[model samples]
Target: MTTDRLTSILNGIGKEISNRQLASILTTGLESFVAEDQAILRTGLAPAPYISASHAHRDGITTQIGGERFSVFRTGRSKSRLNFLSLLRAGHEDYIVNDAALDYMRQRKVAPDVIARLAGHPETSFCSQMAWYDHLVRLRQDVFDPSLVREVSEAAIWGAVRDHGLMGNTVVVSDDAGQFRIPNHALCWVHAERLLQKLMPKTPEQTRKLEAIRDEICASTAI
Candidate 1:
């Protein structure tokens, strides 16, 4: 729930309450719960990983565009969905390689392309070839192996969750490759049924049995 809506409900719907009054009213029970000066509420919930074979959702839209979503909410307007991009720097920041790093990369043939801000430019300044992927892959060649990368990424995700104070209460999720890796997660029935779906039945009887089992699982899950 948003603060403005909560404030309206507290005072009265459509009430004109000042920000100072709202802040004081909202913190009425601070002594009972809050111990620190900070009180954040988000993450480990929104922008969580999606590990489905068929994820035809807006999450797919953002991921395909190389955006790491930080906030996703409807604004109740024409353009409603909001998202944040933390790891989508085009080529300007840390991904901008230093000359020594470039020389080292050149020596190892692990070089990224020099990019241009605009067309019709004579010279090029250095930027990542594939953004963050290139950085990880470059590191993979030297330090981080694939397994290490996965571990590090998982750690980073959880760290982000903590940073946002999403884990202060509790986090729950359904089992899927990326989504289920949280601290407290549970198995999802649909994902579990994918196991049976993967089977290549050699006979009609086997296929029939598998279908029946899948149906039963779905019906049970619905309950």
Candidate 2:
């Protein structure tokens, strides 16, 4: 099927569909349609430049090209639910070794065997591996904050926009507890609704109250 036809069919739907199920509908040589659908679902997070109104989900894809590794993080879509703001290469790499990180592990008196297991490699000695693990742990500690992820991600996206010379505002919709601190950030309705759906009232009064609230919401939405 053509990309336009597939998009039209998918855009018409108001329900959720899984990637595996969507993939199954394809025969062969129609792979681009699936990618386009995913791009739409991701709100234009593809490598090519495109402005998105809003509609983003916090998701990532990993790939290696020309022997270089890349970690791509897609900003959640905006309220308009049109397209993604952009795709940013959140690079992956090993941590740098330093004295502080090593001192930390030494102070904790990490077991020798455990330390050896973490550090040992086919091409390196146990001591070398220990240093590598310590460096990695230190890097992890530096970025342990959830807010840090959001801050860096939003900055990278805006930076991309500036570099590409694009104009327009983009909103981001992500989980309530996600690490996305964009100016246009908003919690995903689907996730919020799912939480509400999970509510199980124990008492009769609670059940009635929950049902009344649900009914009101449904009525308001004309569902």
Candidate number with greatest TM-score: 1
> What's the lDDT for all of these models?
0.39, 0.39
Off by over 4 Å in 1: 6-16, 31-173, 177-179, 182-186, 194-200, 215-223
lDDT of candidate 1 vs native? Answer: 0.39
Q: Name the weakest run of 10 consecutive residues (lDDT summed) in model 1.
A: 76-85
What TM-score against the true fold does each predicted structure earn? Answer: 0.31, 0.26
Per-residue accuracy of model 2 over 179-220 as CA lDDT, tens digit each: 333334554455556767899899999989988877665674
Candidate no. 2 TM-score: 0.26
- Candidate 1 backbone collisions, by pair: none
In order of listing, the candidates' clash counts read 0, 11
lDDT tens digits by residue: candidate 1, 113-198: 32111112322232333443454554443334544433333333333334443343333334454523344444467677878878
